[model samples]
Target: MRLILASTSPYRRELLARLDLPFETLSPQVDETAIPGEAPPETARRLAAAKAAAVARREPDAWVIGSDQVAELDGAALGKPGGREAAVGQLSAMSARAVRFATAVTLQRDEERFHALDSTLVRFRPLSLEEISRYVDAEKPFDCAGSFKSEGLGIALFDAIESRDPTALIGLPLIAVAGLLRKAGFALP
Candidate 1:
């Protein structure tokens, strides 16, 4: 069976590449707006499933993988900040607080499906106003959830991280994803 990744995120793409399995990437265009009364984790799961189903329809015989990440603090969703100002504001709002990043991954082929959600707790260090501004100015992580890229300088902003799968924080949850892929008949070296 062929392998497909239904996302265009560079971080997810890079993480998926670590399995050393050849796969194709496609952008699944699904409405990402959260349903009213849906929790953050459920929203991530729904979006991931929607994305996989959207791409799976295009390749009925291929194995498709879909994933999504949602960051929330105090029940408020923190989406991608479009620019520097928004990124700064997001960081400011999250400073010295605990934020949750829920990452969901799904694998599907034919009529079979497997899914998992990895929620990571990230605690940010108490950040000064100047420090937040400088970090946002230097990193420019406007497209990242929580307005910070843990793989980069953004690590300096977090005091601790609690997660079942570290890769989830990076956006893919590769351990769980790899297991799902194996179950779907993909061999990993």
Candidate 2:
């Protein structure tokens, strides 16, 4: 069966490409609003599964992979910022703090589905207002959750990252997703 990715995120597209497996991409039209009282991890998983199922129903004979990420600090969920000011505020609040980024991945084929969710704990070094402002201005990672891009300039803001799968921090947990794909009968070298 052919494999399909249900997302338009550049980061997710890039991460998926690393597998060296050919796949098609499609946008999954689904509401991403979090349910009332829904936790960050749960939200990520739900969205991932929703995306996969949405695609699976359309391509019942093909494999579909869906993923989502959520960053949470102090129990408050942080999604992509709206603009420069919001990015600055989010980064400022995260400076010198530890944040949990949960990435969820789901694979579905017909009636069978497999999934995984991985959380990466990242500790940021004490950041000056000036530093935060410069990073935001230079990278404009406003579209990223928590207002930082660990794969880019945002790495300078971190003192350490504790994660079983570093790619999870990049937006997709490739290690776990690869396992799920293999179980779903995808050939991976």
| lDDT by candidate, in order shown | 0.91, 0.92
TM-score of 2: 0.98
Candidate 2 Cα lDDT to native: 0.92
lDDT of 1 by residue, 76-141 (tens): 778899898888888888888999999999998867899989999999999988999999889899
**Model 2: per-residue lDDT, tens digit, 79-108?**
999789999898889888999999999999
* Candidate 1 segments whose C-alpha is farther than 4 A from its true place: none
Q: Point to the candidate with the largest TM-score.
A: 2
lDDT of 2 at 29: 90
Please state the error at residue 63 of candidate 1 in Å: 0.7
lDDT top scorer: 2
